[model samples]
Target: MPVPSAPGGAAGPATPPAPHITRRGLALAGLATAQFMVVLDSSIVNVALPSIRRGLDLTPAQLSWVVDGYLVAFAGLLLLGGRLADVFGRRAVLLGGLTAFAAASALCALAPNGPVLVGARIAQGAAGAVMAPAALSIVMTLFPDGPDRARALGVWGGVSGAGGIAGVLLGGVLSQTLGWPWIFVINVPVALAVGAVVLVSVRPFPAAGGSFDIAGAVTVTLAMAGLALGVVMGSDAGWTAPVTPAALVLGLAALAAFVALERRAARPLVPLRVLARPRLAVANTIMLLLGATAAGLFYFLPQYQQNVLGMSPLTTSLTQLPIALTITAGGLLAPRVAAVLGVRLALTTALAWLAVGLAWLARADPHARFLDGLLGPFLLIGAGLGTAFVYVTTLAVAGSAPGETGLVSGLVNTARQMGGAVGLAALVALATATGTPAGTGTPAGHQPNLTAAFLGAAALAATALLLSLTSALHHPAPTAASPLLPGQRTST
Candidate 1:
C-alpha cells in the first residue's frame, strides 16, 4: 500500500511536533485580565471620590486632577506605549506595564495628600498605556484566523464593558467595608497573579525592529497634556485668560508639529497613512463622541443617586447594577447583531438609542423617581454604549497593515480619553453657570447648578448620534478581494 499522506498532506517526512501547550488560550486569558484591570480603574475611584476628597482635603479643582491626571497620562502616552510594544516584545512590555501599574497602585494607596495621589494616578495611567496595546496585540497574534479572532475580540469587549460597572460596585463595597485605599491596594495582588500567569504561558512573538520615535512621543505627550490642562483650567478661568489661550495655542502647535514629524519619520509613532484612511477616521471620531457621553454619564450618575435621590454609597452602587448588567448583555449580543445587520446599521441603531436615553435623562428633576425616571434611560445608555463600542473598534482596526494594529488601537483609545477630558471640562463649566441647588440654607440663588450639565450631556449624546448616522450613511470604498479561504467568508 502507498504510504499514507501525513496530516496536512505533507509529501516529505513529517517535521518534529511543536510544544503541546496552547499558547492562544494562555494569551487570551492574560489579555482579558489586563483589559479588565485597565477598564476597572476608570470607574473604581468614582465611588471613593467623596472619601478621597475629604481625606486628602482636595479642592474641586484638585479633585478633578485625581481623575484627569490618570486620564491625561494614559491618553497621552498610549501611542508611544503601542509603538514600544511593537518595537519590543509584547510579552516583555506587558510584564513591565503590570509591574509599573502595581507599583503605582501601591503608591496611590499610600499617598499622603492630594498631589501624591494625583502623581500616583498619572503613573497608573502611564502603566495602563503600556499594557493595553500589548494585551490587544497578543489577542491578534494568538487568533490569526478571522472567526476565532472575532470571538476573542467579543470576549474582550464584554470584559471591558462589564468592568466599568463592576468597578463602581466593587469600589463601593471595598470603600464602605475596608476603606478607599483598599480600592488601589486590591490591584496589587491581582496584577501580581496575572503577571505570573503571563510570564509562564504567553509565547513571545517576533518584535518589529525599529528605532523608537522619542521626539515624536514627547511632542504628542506634551500636546495632549497641554490640551487637557488647558481645558481643565479653562473651566475655572475664562477661556480668554492669557494662560488658557497660551496653553491651548502651545498644545495645538505641538500637535501640528507631531503630525509633521509623523509624516517625515521613517518609523513614525503613528503612520500618516493609517490616519488618512476614511473608515478609521470616521470610526475614531465616533469613538471620541461615544467616550465623551459614557464618561459624562459615569461622572454624573452618582451625583444623581447620592445628591438628588438621597442614596447612600452602597445603595448608589446597587442602583447602578442595572446599567452594568445591561451593558454586559449588550456586549455579548453586539457581535451577533453586527453580523446580522452589518456594522453601519448596528452602530447607527446603537447611537440612536443612546440619544434617546440621554434625552430622557435630561428631563430628570429633583422630584424624579428612580424606577420611573432613571432605570430605563440607564439601561438604554448601557446597551447602546456596548453595541457602539463593538462597531467602533471593529471599524477602527479593520484591514490595518501588519504591525500597525497596536498603533491604530492606541489612537482610537487616545481619542476616547481625550474626548472624556474635554467633555467633562465643558460640562463642569456649564454646570457652574447654571441654576443653584433647590432649598439651600441661604436662599434660592444658592441652589446648586445641575440643569446645564445634564443638558450638556444630552447634547454630547446627540452629537454622537449624528456622527454615527453620518458614518453609517457614508459608503465604504471598494476593496481588493479578501484572501480568506473559501467557506470562511460567511457572516457570523
Candidate 2:
C-alpha cells in the first residue's frame, strides 16, 4: 500500500486506516458491478426471446430488433459517451447514466408493445454507452498502473466475461420462474444499488479541458450506428437486401467524413495522432478479433447445445457455468502471465490458446456428451478470453495521458462492440451458406451449421494470433506503467 506524503520533508504516515481501504474496495466493487450490469443486459434477453415474443406479440423481425436495437445504439454512442465523461466529469456522467439506465429498464419491463420494448431497449443501450466508459474511467482513476491495476482489472475482466454467460443462465431461470419482464426488472435494482455505492465511495474526477466536438461526435455515431444497422439487417434480410446496402454505404461515408473532420477539428473527440500510436492500434485490432470470437461463440454455443447436442435450455445453461468460471480464473491469471512473458508475448499466447480452443470446438462430435467433447474446449476458450481481455486492455490504456484515459477506454470498448456486432453477422452468414448439406434437412428444421461457425471463429482467432506475432517483430513490447513481476524484463 502507498502511504500519504508528509509536508516539508517530514516522514510519511505509516499506513492508512481501515475505512480508507474499505472505501477503495467499495469503489472498485461498485464500478465492476456497473460494468457487469451493462454487459449482462447485452445477452440477458437471448434466452427469453420466445417468452418476450409471446408476451409482446412480436413479428420475427421485431423480435430480432429487441436484441439488435440495444447493440446498435450501444456500439454507436460509446465514443460520444466517453468524450462526455471527459468533458463533464466521471462521477456526474456515471450517475446520470445509471439513472437513465434504471429508468429505461423500468420502461422495458412495463412496455406494452413490441415497438415500445424495442425503443426502451435502445434507450437502455444509449444509457449503457455512457455508463460503461465512465465506470471504467473511475476504475482507472482508483488504481494506478502496476500490480494493483492489473489485479483490479482481473476482477473487472472476470466479471465482464462472466456476465455474457450469466445472462443466459439468469434469463432462463427468471423467464421460466417469474416472467420475461423479470429480466429487465432485475437490472433496475442492480443499477440503483450500484449508483448508490458509487455515489458514496467514488470521489469525483475533474472534467478534461476542451470544448465538445459536436460535429465529430455526430459523424462517428452515425458511422457506427449505420454500420451496426447494416450488419444486423444483412444477417436478417440477406446481404442483397436494399436497406443493407444503403446502410453500409452511409456508414462508410460517415466514417470517411468523421476521419476528415477529426483531422481538422480544433477540439476533436478522438485525436487521430493518439489513435495512430502503434501499441494502442495493435491492441484495439487484436481486441476486435477477440471480441468477434467471443460474441460469435456465445451466440452459437447455446443453439448448438439445444439443436445438436439435445440439451434442455436449463441444462445448457448449467453446462456453460464452467466456461464462465474458467474465464474469470483466466483473468485472475493474466497479471502473473504478463509478469513472466511481457504484454506482447502474453497477448500472442492468449490468442494462440483461443485459436486452439476454437479449432477443437470446430470438430466436436454432435453425438458426444458435454464432458466428452464440449467441456475441454470451453475451458480452453474461457481461459484464453480471460487472459487476452486483460493483456489487450492493458496495452490500450498503458501509455495514455491522464486526461485521455476516458477516450482510450471508449476506443477499446467501441472496438469490441463493433467487432461483436459485425463479426457475429459475418459468422452467421458463413454458417448459413455452408452449415447445411445440399438437399438435406436436420431435425431442428434447418439449423445453421454451428460447427462451421466455430471453424470461422477459430480462423478469426488464428488471424489475431498471426497479427500479434507480426506486431512483435516490428515493435518492442510497450513498457509504460505496465505490470511486470519483480526483476522481469519488459521485452522478451
Candidate 3:
C-alpha cells in the first residue's frame, strides 16, 4: 500500500510520466471522455432494444444477448485488462482498446443481423474492459493525491453517472429519429476523437515487466465470465433452469481454482496480499453493495415510468434529468465533504442518504405523482450515488502502490460490474415473486412489484452504509500535502 510522495508518483520501467505530461488538462479531458464513452455504451442500447428486435428480426433470447453480451465480456475481462496494462504499458493498452472499440462500434452500426450485432457488442465490451482501467490509471498518474486528485475523480464520477442517464435519452432520440444504427455510429467518431486527444496529451508510462501468469488469468477470467453469465441466465430463464445452476457452480469452481493457483504462482494475475489488505477489502465490499443498489435503481426506475405511469421513452428520459444533474452536483461536492469528514465518513454519509432515498421510493404507487413521489427521492439517490462513486474510488485508488493503479482500478470496477449483474437478477426475482398472484401466472398488464425491488435496493445501500462504518475504513483527516490525502502514506 505504499505510494509515492510527489506528482506522477511512480513509473514501471519507462521514463517517469509526470515530467512528460505537459498537457495535464488535455490529458484529463481525454481520460474522462474515454471513461464517459465506456459508461455511455453500457446503457445506450437499452432504449433501442425494441427497435433492434424489429430491425433484425431477433428472438427474445437474441435480443437479450445484445445487452448481456456486452456486460458479460466487460465484466469478465476487466481484471485481465488491468493486468495487461500493468505488464504491457497503460498507454499502449489504452490506445489499442480505443482502436478496437471504434472498429467494433463501426461493425455494430453496419451489422446485417442479430448475431453480427451481438458479436460486435461483445467485441465492444472486451475493448471497453481494456480501455476503462488504463484510462483510470492514467488519471491517477496525472494528478497526485490530495485536492487535485479528488477534484479530478469528481469530474470523472460526474461524467460516469451522467453518461448512464444521457445514454437513455440519446438512445430514445436517435433510435426513433435516425435508426438504431446511429447509436453505435456516434461512438465511432467519439472513440476516435478521444483516442486522438489522448495520443497527443498523455505520456507513456513504463510497464511493470514480468512473466504473465497464464494459468491464473485463464481461471479468473473464466470465473468472472461464468458468474456473470449465470446471473444473466437466471434473470432471463429463471434460477431453476439447469444452465443457471450449472454456470454458477462452474464459476464457483473456477474461482476456487484461481485462488488456489494464485497462492502458489510466482507471478500471479492478482496478488493475494493486495486483496487481503483490510482497507482494500472493506472498500471493495462496500463498493459492491453500493453498485448493486445503484444498478437496480437505474434498471427498474425507467420501467416504472414507462410501464406503470405510461410515460413515453423521451418523457421518461426528461423526467430523469434531475437525477443526472443532482448526481453531477453531488460528485463535484464530494471532495469538499471528504476534505472535511475524511473518505470513510463521507462515503458512509452518502450510502445512508441513498438508503433513505430508496426506502422512500419503495412507497411509490401507480397513482403517485412525479414531483411528489419520484423527484424527491431521485434527488437524494442521485446525490448519494455521485458522492459515493467519488469517495469509494478515491479510497481504493489512494493507497495503491506505485505502478499498480491499473490492478486496483480493475478490482473496484469488477466489483461494481459483478454486483450489477447479481443485483439485477435478484431484484427481478424478488419483484416477480412479490407481484405474482398465488397459483396464477402473471397476466399481461400486471407488472412486477417494483416497490419491493426498490426496498431491496434500499437494503443493499443500508448494508453498505453499515460496512463503511467498519474500523478498517477509518483514516486521518485531509490537508494540503497530507499523505492521507494521496501521497506516501496509506489513506486506509
The global C-alpha lDDT for each of the candidates, from Candidate 1 onward, is 0.70, 0.73, 0.73
Which sections of candidate 1 miss by over 4 Å? 1-28, 143-155, 203-208, 240-242, 339-341, 397-409, 435-448, 471-473, 478-492
List the RMSD of every prediction in angstroms: 7.9, 6.5, 5.4
lDDT of 2 by residue, 414-433 (tens): 77766776676667666765
Candidate that scores best on TM-score: 1
lDDT of 3 by residue, 166-209 (tens): 78688778887899899999998998999899889877776777
Q: How many pairs of residues collide in each model? A: 4, 0, 0
Candidate 2's C-alpha lDDT? 0.73
TM per model? 0.85, 0.81, 0.80
Residue 222, model 2: lDDT of 74
Q: Write the per-residue lDDT of candidate 1 for residues 254-277, one digit (tens) a residue.
A: 899999998899877777887778
TM-score leaderboard ranking: 1, 2, 3
Clashing pairs in 1: 436-447, 436-448, 437-447, 437-448
Flag clash pairs in model 3: none
